[model samples]
Target: MSKVRGTNTLPEMRVRRALHSMDYRFRLHRPDLPGKPDIVLQKHRVCIFVHGCFWHSHPGCVRATTPESNGEFWAKKLAGNVERDRRSALELAEMGWRVCVIWECETRYTDALVLAVNRCMKHSGPISL
Candidate 1:
Protein backbone atom coordinates (compact mmCIF):
# COMPACT_ATOMS: atom_id res chain seq x y z
CA MET A 1 0.00 0.00 0.00
CA SER A 2 2.90 2.33 0.71
CA LYS A 3 4.58 1.44 -2.59
CA VAL A 4 3.68 4.64 -4.42
CA ARG A 5 4.03 6.69 -1.23
CA GLY A 6 1.36 8.99 -2.66
CA THR A 7 3.51 10.22 -5.54
CA ASN A 8 4.81 9.13 -8.91
CA THR A 9 2.35 6.31 -9.29
CA LEU A 10 1.81 4.55 -12.63
CA PRO A 11 -1.38 6.42 -13.46
CA GLU A 12 0.10 9.74 -12.42
CA MET A 13 3.07 9.17 -14.65
CA ARG A 14 0.86 8.30 -17.58
CA VAL A 15 -1.12 11.46 -17.14
CA ARG A 16 2.04 13.48 -16.95
CA ARG A 17 3.27 11.95 -20.16
CA ALA A 18 0.07 12.80 -21.98
CA LEU A 19 0.14 16.35 -20.69
CA HIS A 20 3.74 16.75 -21.73
CA SER A 21 3.03 15.45 -25.22
CA MET A 22 0.29 18.02 -25.46
CA ASP A 23 2.88 20.76 -24.84
CA TYR A 24 1.36 21.76 -21.52
CA ARG A 25 4.05 22.65 -19.02
CA PHE A 26 3.07 22.01 -15.41
CA ARG A 27 4.27 21.50 -11.84
CA LEU A 28 3.79 18.44 -9.71
CA HIS A 29 2.26 18.04 -6.23
CA ARG A 30 2.15 21.69 -5.31
CA PRO A 31 2.12 21.59 -1.49
CA ASP A 32 0.55 25.03 -1.19
CA LEU A 33 -2.66 23.76 -2.77
CA PRO A 34 -5.39 21.76 -1.16
CA GLY A 35 -4.77 17.97 -1.44
CA LYS A 36 -1.45 18.72 -3.11
CA PRO A 37 -2.79 17.84 -6.52
CA ASP A 38 -0.74 15.34 -8.51
CA ILE A 39 -0.30 17.78 -11.38
CA VAL A 40 -0.64 21.52 -11.15
CA LEU A 41 -0.90 23.73 -14.20
CA GLN A 42 -0.87 27.07 -12.46
CA LYS A 43 -0.71 28.93 -15.77
CA HIS A 44 -4.09 27.46 -16.60
CA ARG A 45 -5.31 27.45 -12.98
CA VAL A 46 -6.09 23.75 -13.26
CA CYS A 47 -5.43 21.05 -10.63
CA ILE A 48 -5.44 17.40 -11.59
CA PHE A 49 -5.76 14.57 -9.09
CA VAL A 50 -4.74 11.12 -10.25
CA HIS A 51 -6.93 8.94 -8.08
CA GLY A 52 -6.76 5.17 -7.67
CA CYS A 53 -10.11 3.59 -8.36
CA PHE A 54 -9.84 1.42 -5.26
CA TRP A 55 -8.38 3.87 -2.79
CA HIS A 56 -10.60 6.75 -3.89
CA SER A 57 -13.62 4.46 -4.06
CA HIS A 58 -14.46 5.06 -7.69
CA PRO A 59 -18.22 4.66 -7.98
CA GLY A 60 -19.42 1.84 -10.22
CA CYS A 61 -15.85 0.60 -10.62
CA VAL A 62 -15.13 -3.10 -10.18
CA ARG A 63 -11.70 -2.34 -8.79
CA ALA A 64 -13.23 -0.70 -5.76
CA THR A 65 -13.98 -3.92 -4.01
CA THR A 66 -14.58 -4.39 -0.33
CA PRO A 67 -12.77 -6.94 1.78
CA GLU A 68 -14.91 -9.78 3.03
CA SER A 69 -12.95 -9.76 6.24
CA ASN A 70 -12.81 -6.62 8.41
CA GLY A 71 -15.76 -5.24 6.55
CA GLU A 72 -16.35 -2.43 9.01
CA PHE A 73 -12.77 -1.23 8.97
CA TRP A 74 -12.45 -1.18 5.19
CA ALA A 75 -15.78 0.54 4.81
CA LYS A 76 -14.86 3.35 7.17
CA LYS A 77 -11.39 3.67 5.75
CA LEU A 78 -12.51 3.93 2.15
CA ALA A 79 -15.29 6.27 3.10
CA GLY A 80 -12.81 8.58 4.76
CA ASN A 81 -10.66 8.59 1.66
CA VAL A 82 -13.59 9.60 -0.49
CA GLU A 83 -14.70 12.30 1.93
CA ARG A 84 -11.23 13.79 2.04
CA ASP A 85 -11.05 13.84 -1.74
CA ARG A 86 -14.39 15.60 -1.94
CA ARG A 87 -13.25 18.21 0.53
CA SER A 88 -10.01 18.86 -1.29
CA ALA A 89 -11.74 19.31 -4.62
CA LEU A 90 -14.24 21.70 -3.06
CA GLU A 91 -11.50 23.73 -1.49
CA LEU A 92 -9.60 23.98 -4.76
CA ALA A 93 -12.71 25.10 -6.62
CA GLU A 94 -13.59 27.72 -4.01
CA MET A 95 -10.08 29.08 -4.42
CA GLY A 96 -10.85 29.68 -8.12
CA TRP A 97 -9.05 26.63 -9.45
CA ARG A 98 -10.41 24.21 -12.01
CA VAL A 99 -10.08 20.74 -10.49
CA CYS A 100 -9.96 17.58 -12.59
CA VAL A 101 -9.79 13.97 -11.42
CA ILE A 102 -8.26 11.35 -13.69
CA TRP A 103 -9.07 8.00 -12.18
CA GLU A 104 -6.71 5.03 -12.38
CA CYS A 105 -9.12 3.20 -14.63
CA GLU A 106 -9.17 6.09 -17.04
CA THR A 107 -5.40 5.96 -17.44
CA ARG A 108 -5.53 2.44 -18.84
CA TYR A 109 -6.35 3.77 -22.29
CA THR A 110 -3.77 6.26 -23.45
CA ASP A 111 -5.79 7.74 -26.30
CA ALA A 112 -8.92 8.25 -24.26
CA LEU A 113 -6.97 9.75 -21.39
CA VAL A 114 -5.30 12.23 -23.68
CA LEU A 115 -8.58 13.26 -25.22
CA ALA A 116 -10.17 13.65 -21.79
CA VAL A 117 -7.31 15.78 -20.58
CA ASN A 118 -7.52 18.00 -23.61
CA ARG A 119 -11.25 18.34 -23.22
CA CYS A 120 -11.01 19.19 -19.52
CA MET A 121 -8.39 21.82 -20.13
CA LYS A 122 -10.70 23.55 -22.57
CA HIS A 123 -13.61 23.70 -20.13
CA SER A 124 -14.44 26.80 -18.13
CA GLY A 125 -15.33 25.32 -14.74
CA PRO A 126 -14.15 22.45 -12.58
CA ILE A 127 -14.41 19.07 -14.29
CA SER A 128 -13.57 16.97 -11.26
CA LEU A 129 -16.94 15.88 -9.94
Candidate 2:
Protein backbone atom coordinates (compact mmCIF):
# COMPACT_ATOMS: atom_id res chain seq x y z
CA MET A 1 0.00 0.00 0.00
CA SER A 2 3.01 2.25 0.46
CA LYS A 3 3.38 2.51 -3.30
CA VAL A 4 -0.20 3.57 -3.87
CA ARG A 5 -0.36 7.05 -5.32
CA GLY A 6 -3.20 9.50 -4.85
CA THR A 7 -2.19 12.18 -7.33
CA ASN A 8 -0.08 12.95 -10.37
CA THR A 9 -0.62 9.44 -11.64
CA LEU A 10 0.04 8.41 -15.25
CA PRO A 11 -3.66 8.35 -16.02
CA GLU A 12 -4.06 11.84 -14.58
CA MET A 13 -1.10 13.07 -16.62
CA ARG A 14 -2.59 11.56 -19.74
CA VAL A 15 -5.82 13.47 -19.23
CA ARG A 16 -3.92 16.68 -18.53
CA ARG A 17 -1.91 16.25 -21.68
CA ALA A 18 -5.02 15.65 -23.72
CA LEU A 19 -6.62 18.80 -22.32
CA HIS A 20 -3.51 20.84 -23.04
CA SER A 21 -3.29 19.56 -26.56
CA MET A 22 -6.88 20.55 -27.07
CA ASP A 23 -5.92 24.10 -26.04
CA TYR A 24 -7.76 23.85 -22.73
CA ARG A 25 -6.24 25.45 -19.65
CA PHE A 26 -6.71 23.96 -16.16
CA ARG A 27 -5.45 23.88 -12.57
CA LEU A 28 -4.22 20.81 -10.72
CA HIS A 29 -6.03 19.67 -7.59
CA ARG A 30 -7.63 22.66 -5.91
CA PRO A 31 -7.63 21.81 -2.20
CA ASP A 32 -10.53 24.15 -1.42
CA LEU A 33 -12.96 21.90 -3.28
CA PRO A 34 -14.41 18.51 -2.41
CA GLY A 35 -12.16 15.52 -3.32
CA LYS A 36 -9.60 17.98 -4.69
CA PRO A 37 -10.40 17.04 -8.27
CA ASP A 38 -7.47 15.95 -10.38
CA ILE A 39 -7.94 18.76 -12.86
CA VAL A 40 -9.91 21.98 -12.65
CA LEU A 41 -10.86 24.43 -15.35
CA GLN A 42 -11.73 27.26 -13.02
CA LYS A 43 -12.94 29.55 -15.76
CA HIS A 44 -15.55 27.03 -16.92
CA ARG A 45 -16.53 25.76 -13.45
CA VAL A 46 -15.41 22.23 -14.38
CA CYS A 47 -13.62 19.66 -12.26
CA ILE A 48 -12.02 16.43 -13.56
CA PHE A 49 -11.33 13.43 -11.39
CA VAL A 50 -8.89 10.81 -12.72
CA HIS A 51 -9.96 7.75 -10.74
CA GLY A 52 -8.07 4.49 -10.56
CA CYS A 53 -10.27 1.51 -11.44
CA PHE A 54 -9.42 -0.44 -8.30
CA TRP A 55 -9.33 2.44 -5.89
CA HIS A 56 -12.63 3.95 -6.98
CA SER A 57 -14.31 0.60 -7.69
CA HIS A 58 -15.21 1.16 -11.31
CA PRO A 59 -18.26 -1.00 -12.00
CA GLY A 60 -17.77 -3.84 -14.54
CA CYS A 61 -14.08 -3.10 -14.69
CA VAL A 62 -11.86 -6.15 -14.69
CA ARG A 63 -9.00 -4.48 -12.86
CA ALA A 64 -11.24 -3.73 -9.92
CA THR A 65 -10.89 -7.21 -8.45
CA THR A 66 -9.92 -7.93 -4.85
CA PRO A 67 -7.62 -10.55 -3.38
CA GLU A 68 -8.95 -13.60 -1.59
CA SER A 69 -6.73 -12.87 1.37
CA ASN A 70 -8.11 -10.16 3.65
CA GLY A 71 -11.13 -9.92 1.39
CA GLU A 72 -13.17 -8.20 4.10
CA PHE A 73 -10.66 -5.41 4.54
CA TRP A 74 -10.35 -4.87 0.80
CA ALA A 75 -14.12 -4.76 0.33
CA LYS A 76 -14.57 -2.22 3.10
CA LYS A 77 -11.73 -0.06 1.88
CA LEU A 78 -13.01 -0.09 -1.70
CA ALA A 79 -16.56 0.60 -0.58
CA GLY A 80 -15.35 3.57 1.42
CA ASN A 81 -13.59 4.93 -1.61
CA VAL A 82 -16.74 4.70 -3.68
CA GLU A 83 -18.80 6.38 -0.96
CA ARG A 84 -16.38 9.26 -0.57
CA ASP A 85 -16.30 9.75 -4.33
CA ARG A 86 -20.08 9.87 -4.47
CA ARG A 87 -20.27 12.45 -1.68
CA SER A 88 -17.62 14.64 -3.21
CA ALA A 89 -19.26 14.58 -6.63
CA LEU A 90 -22.61 15.50 -5.11
CA GLU A 91 -21.08 18.37 -3.16
CA LEU A 92 -19.39 19.73 -6.24
CA ALA A 93 -22.64 19.53 -8.18
CA GLU A 94 -24.45 21.42 -5.43
CA MET A 95 -21.75 24.09 -5.69
CA GLY A 96 -22.63 24.43 -9.40
CA TRP A 97 -19.42 22.84 -10.58
CA ARG A 98 -19.32 20.38 -13.47
CA VAL A 99 -17.51 17.20 -12.53
CA CYS A 100 -15.97 14.68 -14.95
CA VAL A 101 -14.46 11.39 -13.93
CA ILE A 102 -11.89 9.93 -16.35
CA TRP A 103 -11.18 6.36 -15.39
CA GLU A 104 -7.69 4.87 -15.52
CA CYS A 105 -8.74 2.20 -18.02
CA GLU A 106 -10.11 4.84 -20.36
CA THR A 107 -6.77 6.58 -20.41
CA ARG A 108 -5.17 3.57 -22.06
CA TYR A 109 -6.64 4.59 -25.39
CA THR A 110 -5.33 8.05 -26.22
CA ASP A 111 -7.54 8.83 -29.20
CA ALA A 112 -10.72 7.74 -27.50
CA LEU A 113 -9.70 9.53 -24.36
CA VAL A 114 -9.33 12.79 -26.26
CA LEU A 115 -12.74 12.42 -27.83
CA ALA A 116 -14.26 11.59 -24.45
CA VAL A 117 -12.70 14.65 -22.90
CA ASN A 118 -13.92 16.80 -25.74
CA ARG A 119 -17.43 15.47 -25.37
CA CYS A 120 -17.38 16.09 -21.64
CA MET A 121 -16.29 19.69 -22.17
CA LYS A 122 -18.99 20.25 -24.74
CA HIS A 123 -21.67 19.20 -22.29
CA SER A 124 -20.39 21.63 -19.70
CA GLY A 125 -21.58 24.71 -21.65
CA PRO A 126 -20.65 27.19 -24.32
CA ILE A 127 -16.94 27.23 -23.75
CA SER A 128 -14.50 28.43 -26.41
CA LEU A 129 -11.84 25.89 -25.69
Question: Considering every candidate listed, which one attains the maximal TM-score?
Answer: 2
Residue 87, candidate 2: Cα error in Å is 0.3
Candidate 1 ranges beyond 4 A from true positions: 123-129
Overall local distance difference test of candidate 2:
0.87
lDDT of every predicted structure (CA atoms): 0.88, 0.87
lDDT (tens digit, per residue) of candidate 2 on 1-129: 999888889999888888897788999989999999989998889999999998889989999998789999999999999999999999999999998888899889876686668766875533222
TM-score of 1: 0.90
**lDDT of each residue in 65-127, candidate 1, tens digit only:** 988899999999999999999999999999999999998988898666866686669855433
